[model samples]
Target: MKSPINLEVVHKVIDVFRAQYKNRDLAAKTEKILFNLAATGHRVSEQNFRAIVGHIRNHDMMSPWFIVSNVNTGYWITKDEKELSAYLDQELNRMSNQFDNVSNLHKRLRHGKTKGTGNQASLF
Candidate 1:
């Protein structure tokens, strides 16, 4: 698994979003963290900060997977079978990894120059 992003980068991205949105809540969080770091007199680099914030924003803004629902007689109802099936198909296509790994392994084997071992023990 990839390593978690550095705290300094996370703080930088939060700072930029707070600046852009002028959100007091977000700004407050950023300020609290940044101020604590400053109190210790440790400075994080701007470039590293920007990159981390960029990654955070990119990840944060992703749309959720959803299927539409309807209400009838003051009751919430599940989506129609057709709509549900379509949504399932789309989500399955998006999440499927069978082809991706298979093709990569095929390409690697095709390009590899290694020959079979001549000894019977090697085959075993």
Candidate 2:
């Protein structure tokens, strides 16, 4: 059986995440959080740390406290509802664009296959 994630580590990470709201200089990246935990002799695996963060984000813990992540900015905690709503909008737009791109790619692949122009046809 897989071992449970350490509750102590989860709380520690939450504390560190909350501190980022106060200290803008402190980055809430995965590496930074891991480093902070290590400094206090709390050794947590990166996988475990990510899992904990995902849970916290999923449950929307500490209402009005939003943990938003973006490709450019990584992860960040915000108390402003406006900021959180904007982030949600941005993510939705990004995912929509990605879905369109993927659909177009699939159409192109199908067109090529119908034309017998697929590059790896003989490899089968």
Candidate 3:
């Protein structure tokens, strides 16, 4: 599928990091993580950023799987749908597991507290 943003520009952006610390092999991956800068002139104004995005949308060249994660630190724009799907699934599983773990711990603590503090003799 055709893409609106020239990948060369994107690669150049990556080159900035590669050049910074004299790292020879950064190994440019197939997926691109683009941090949405929006507008460089104003820190908060999203006008120019919206314009650029609008133009790209008008072109309608982006793939169906194209998405930008509004994650903290930077925006991740990836064309690799398969990779993104797997990554999201992994994150979902991890987060759910963590929540379950916390919930279980809380329940255990609460149960133990109730057992120790409750007046069992009165019930008997």
* Best candidate according to lDDT: 2
**What's the lDDT of the predicted structure labeled candidate 3?**
0.40
Off by over 4 Å in 2: 1-4, 23-25, 101-124
Error of 1 at 8 (Å): 6.7
lDDT of 1: 0.41
lDDT per residue, candidate 1, 1-124, as tens digits?
Answer: 5455676645543443334333222223334444444555645454444355446535653123111212221111122466546545765765566555465555555455444423222221
lDDT of each: 0.41, 0.70, 0.40
Task: Put the candidates in TM-score order, highest first.
Answer: 2, 3, 1
- Look at candidate 3 and give me any clashing residue pairs: none
Error of 3 at 8 (Å): 27
Candidate 3 TM-score over all chains jointly = 0.32
Model 2 collision count: 0
How many clashes does the backbone of model 3 have? 0
Give the candidate order by descending lDDT: 2, 1, 3
Q: lDDT per residue, candidate 2, 1-124, as tens digits?
A: 6567677877777777786633223446677768878887888888888788777877776456766766655677777677778888998999888776666666666664654466543422
Q: In candidate 3, which residue ranges exceed 4 Å CA deviation?
A: 1-39, 42-75, 109-124
Better of 2 and 3 by TM-score: 2
Worst 10 residues of 2 by lDDT: 115-124
> What's the residue-level lDDT of 1 in candidate 1?
57
- In order of appearance, the predictions have TM-scores of 0.25, 0.64, 0.32
